[model samples]
Target: MAPQDRLTATFTRADRVAPTPLRSIPQLRVDGLSVSYGPHEVVTNVSFELGRGESLALIGESGSGKSTIARAVLRLLPSGGHATGRVAFDGQEVLGISERGFRPLRGRAIGFVPQDPANSLNPVRTIGAQAQEAAALLDEPDKAIRKQLILETFAQVGLDTPLRVYDSYPHQLSGGMLQRVLIGLAILPRPALLVADEPTSALDVTIQKRILDLLTRLQHDLKISLLLITHDLAIAAERADSLVVLKDGVIQEAGRTASVFSSPASAYAKKLRADVPALNPDRYAALRDTGFRSLKTGQAPKIEVSAVTKTFTVDGKALTAVDDLSFSVPAGTTHALVGESGSGKTTTVRLLLGLEGPDTGSISVAGEQITGRSPEALRTVWRHLQLVYQNPFTSLDPTWTIERLVREPLDRFKIGTRKERDERVREALANVGLGEHLLSRKPGALSGGQRQRVAIARSLVLKPDVIVLDEPTSALDVSVQAGIVEVLLSLQATLGLTYVFVSHDLALVRQLAHTVSVMHRGRIVEHGTVADIFDNPQQPYTRSLLASIPSGGNDVAHMRTRAFG
Candidate 1:
């Protein structure tokens, strides 16, 4: 079946499940919940109640202790972690219970879906085997029946080729596919409460919508309470009934999702709302209005790809990674390439960066051809082009200090002396708003936002004309992403830099890119200005992508009326 057909089939299954009536009694309740890891108290006096068939979202940035609270409920905290609280599920106390006591209630009564599917599943095990284990936890004694039920659940979750997915390992599937598998496993037991922690953070917008929809359908059909932990306020507004805002292990505010979004009671909540790029209409207008001034001056385009085509062999079959792809980025402007995982966005980047040779077509950087350049010849071109990768944690060397990491580019180019290199590193750090104190610290010691800043600094140290940002802010929180976006805008305006931003985040793309290209299956489906693509998308795929975005307009209006009236 085709991708669209698979998606349609999935939607059909999701829509078939009718909403179950909610029960009156509280399904899960936590009172005076306080969790600590050794001497450090992460969660302090957090309290919330989740009624049957209700959805409650815990929203906060990293280190806010939202996830810690989720783990505390399951009694799945690390060895050093301790919990001081009353956790009741269906009128039964869960905290302070023995492992054996909690065993029966875990997968049988409550289900868990973690953030990263990659980290949750055993890479060595087959998907069917892992799912079968989950089925066993539900006390399904008969082997033949359990296997049949597992496959049925997989089909219900919209796995097109259930047998293929069942036999495949974790590493063989995409993030969206893996997430669906995990969701399928979680719902197989038909638990009363489903805890989804950042379940869609790593997925594309369209895939995220499908997953959320599936979860909603499951909740309605199974009459299960949902405890969703996420950093995205938009998702919370769309999918959750109530919102619990946490900061530094403390509850900042608690209320209906719409009410909180419309008029946040806490400063943190308001800040988060302001940070969401989609909510702020005028945030990027000024930046965009700055316009492509360099384009009018008759300057050549900074980066150009003319009919570039790249193919790779996978499973003894030829896969066209990038098929006759063509796009250009003018100087001092941002051009975004938006697509799903296998849409050839990364392949195009690889082609542009000279990491891989295109089978056909030409790529140029600053008017210099780079498609067939030798390594020695391309060394000069490397100075004018740099890439800031997706994950800062994994990209930076753990053993190296911040100074060494940032200076490695300059050292490789043999651009400066020790003093000059130190000055350059300091200057780069300052540009990204990092202080000298972090110079000696390694990437591990820095926070997510700080490490990303370091990565940007490393890329800027070369003072490249074009910086290819590959999902640079996708893994970050909204506020952190806003900060990074602001930094990039500032850098572009001041230094007159060009950016080729590759991302799945349409919201961020709207705020950052002047021009947009929507790729689907190795081809550019749509290309135009940001307004044209977002406000008036011409292609069906682009329109579908836009529709997939969770719009909280209805919730906002409902909140407004409820709060004021």
Candidate 2:
């Protein structure tokens, strides 16, 4: 089914019915909700109401008080965080209830789907055991009844082979699948209110859409009120009925999603909307022509992979990650290898970087082949290649100053002496738009976007000819991501470097890549220019990916792709 069909399918869940009836009165009400963590107050003077099946999204960047408000509503705040709010659910004053009294109301009246499914699920337990345990808490269960419900819930979220999934452990599934299992357990009890915190952040665009559609459908059918907490404006616009914009623990804006998105009342709301990245047809056209034109001639491949393959043995099970796949990267351009998690994009990068040895393959940089080479043989080649990882914080040492971090690369590669290294570090910081003062600061002292800049500066300090960027900007804000992409393009032009950019963000991919390769199950399903890939994709999977991208236009033809096929 297309997204248009799915949207129509969503209508079948309900007939635009009134919000769910409040069984007792006021489904949930928070009055003067002020929650303090130790002596520091996180949520202050917050008040909201969820009438029956209504959905109210809490939108903000990281460090906002959205999560705190959810925790206070469930009385699950961390130690020293005392909530001074009058919380009423089912006509009972929940704030006055004791711990014992609150226990029954938890899963029965309110269900919580946390941000990280890894943190929520028991790693040692099978999906069936966990789901059954969760269900048992709500009712005296027969094994058949519990298993049937579990299978039904799994299928409802579009997971294939529900029985196989139930029998498998959490580690056996992908991140998206694990999240769906967690969602199933949360809603199995049929709680009146569901609190979802960054539910789809970890999943791919396609899986994210499926999960969103499932949650929305469940909310409608079950008449369950929803408190959606996330930083994505597109997601808020699509799923939420009402929106509450928060900044620095303060309410920036609050209103219906349609009205707020159409014309935000506050400056913060306007800025957030402005920050979102949209497609640029002209730039995309330019990138498309460049890739095909460059490819037709006998120009040097930016990167060349011939007969590349990979395999790994996990827990005694042999897994083939990549299977004899090959591709090329043109000089002075971006060649993106895109796929979902476990689709071998990262494996390909690892093989190219010599982090892992391939069973059989050859990798060519510019024109020089360097595969299955000894450590000593590739050491010299690594000088011209650098890698930018997903998380900048983990990549950068907390104890090392930015100057030391950047200069260490130069020192290791023996490009410069102490004085020259110092000079190079200063210049590199400036190149990445960081100042001299920031060079002395540690990673913890900087923000997420700044930390990523430092990581880029470190990679650039060596003046590499090719940079392998692995989801470098995926974890950043849309506005910050735009800045990072601008910096990368500017640096690529100035340094005349090629990039093997690996990512799953289709919108960002359209904005960045000169050539695009869509990977599925460790195989390249579609290979073409960005325009060819997005505007006229040949492969069904590529079409699905293009369709998954959020399009607010009311064109039924445009939104025809369903969440998952």
Candidate 3:
């Protein structure tokens, strides 16, 4: 039979035998699993189980061995990596099997969806070719049947144009679409268990919601067991039936998702809960209400954007990137521009920072007209207006030391003599809570959060009046993001720095932004205070974005209640 029709038969079977009761044989189980690499133990005594058609989350910080355990489960450990203990799928031990014997278990009985789709898919091959190649590994051998299955899976994964997506290369699709394609490829063979590792961490909140909802539906309708590995506590809390909190290669806590969050036993688990923005929704919002760096209303606004329109030539056609955008950021406050990937947030920030002149309208920072300025003139504007890029890993020169990286702006502007510039560099480092010892180290030596902090310190070195932060924390994990946010808040309160923040995460924006503009299709759909925008949004697009926030842990919570009853 064709794979598409085979998938339909599998669904019919699932409908007849779904939601295996509590105490049944688990679909996946790990008992006392310990993994070591070159005599260095990374995962120790980790134990967890996923019930049939259920999801279990493994959550922790980086180097916590979450992925290590996952790799061990799939027998994909890297060089010198050794795993001991039990990994059972469908009550059969998988670890004892040899490589030749294990080959059949993969792609037929088990499927894996890794974190990065860009690396997972072949860049040079058409999506259809790649899907067909993957399909050939299973029982389906007919080319036409494989093509039909691939198209059916693509459409089912919410791709509106399956044929177009099938014909296009991986680069032609957006990150979210690529992720959907990857998921579809994994499930095309009707695997019994799906392992998703950091599946939506890099996506926009709206897209993340869709991907997660799709996963939930796959679990419910297809009755596939799921093992979710993520550092995001909010997603783990809402999506998993059970949670295993890992730290330093050991299981810190494990229990029903709702039970653990309600009264976490481990300090690590509690700290993770405290740091997640969705769980503690109001932590940073109080700062705006407490008169912290209250806006200097009487003073000239820090950023004045008047009817700005930015256009670009894409494929020999005029593309309006930002259309008639107008917003004022009061001095010493944060104004966030939020939208989907193509919604003009980046273009608006580019125009505001004078990186690009507007096609129409004017932009002024601190009352200085920035529109239509020569590059030499904009150099002066750049001194008072700096930018913090999205990914610090790429932004900071890997070859430069942290001190030199932070000191570049000051050196460029010739702000001070050798001694004074050195002193300013120290001050900037101190501002972000980085010690002097890290000065000699390059960005490669630092963690993601530390690198971002160094990035922030660099922007602050010039003591710019306005800073454009473009998705500064999106690249970091949740706790690291929280740490970076704390530093930014402290810096803003102490220095009264004006900020233009850009992000696709409404949850993060709610905590950080004073005023927010919801951008869509290169236009401002709604603009208002964070409170007004969230509580009483006026636009349908704005409401949809707000509604996309992940709160699906309730499904597993409900299952817990049902099982206990």
TM-scores for all candidates: the values are: 0.93, 0.87, 0.95
Worst 10 residues of 1 by lDDT: 10-19
The better candidate by lDDT, 2 or 3, is 3
In order, how many clashes per candidate? Answer: 0, 7, 1
Per residue, candidate 2 scores C-alpha lDDT tens digits across 326-417 of: 88887777889888887789888898898888788888886666786788888877888889999998999899998889888887778866
Query: Which candidate has the highest TM-score of all?
Result: 3
Per-residue lDDT of candidate 3, residues 360-427 (tens digit): 99999998999989889999989989899999999999999998999998888888799999999999
| lDDT per residue as tens, model 1, 394-508 | 9999999999999999998898898999999999999999999999999999999999999999999999999999999988999899999999998988898999999998888
TM-score of 2: 0.87
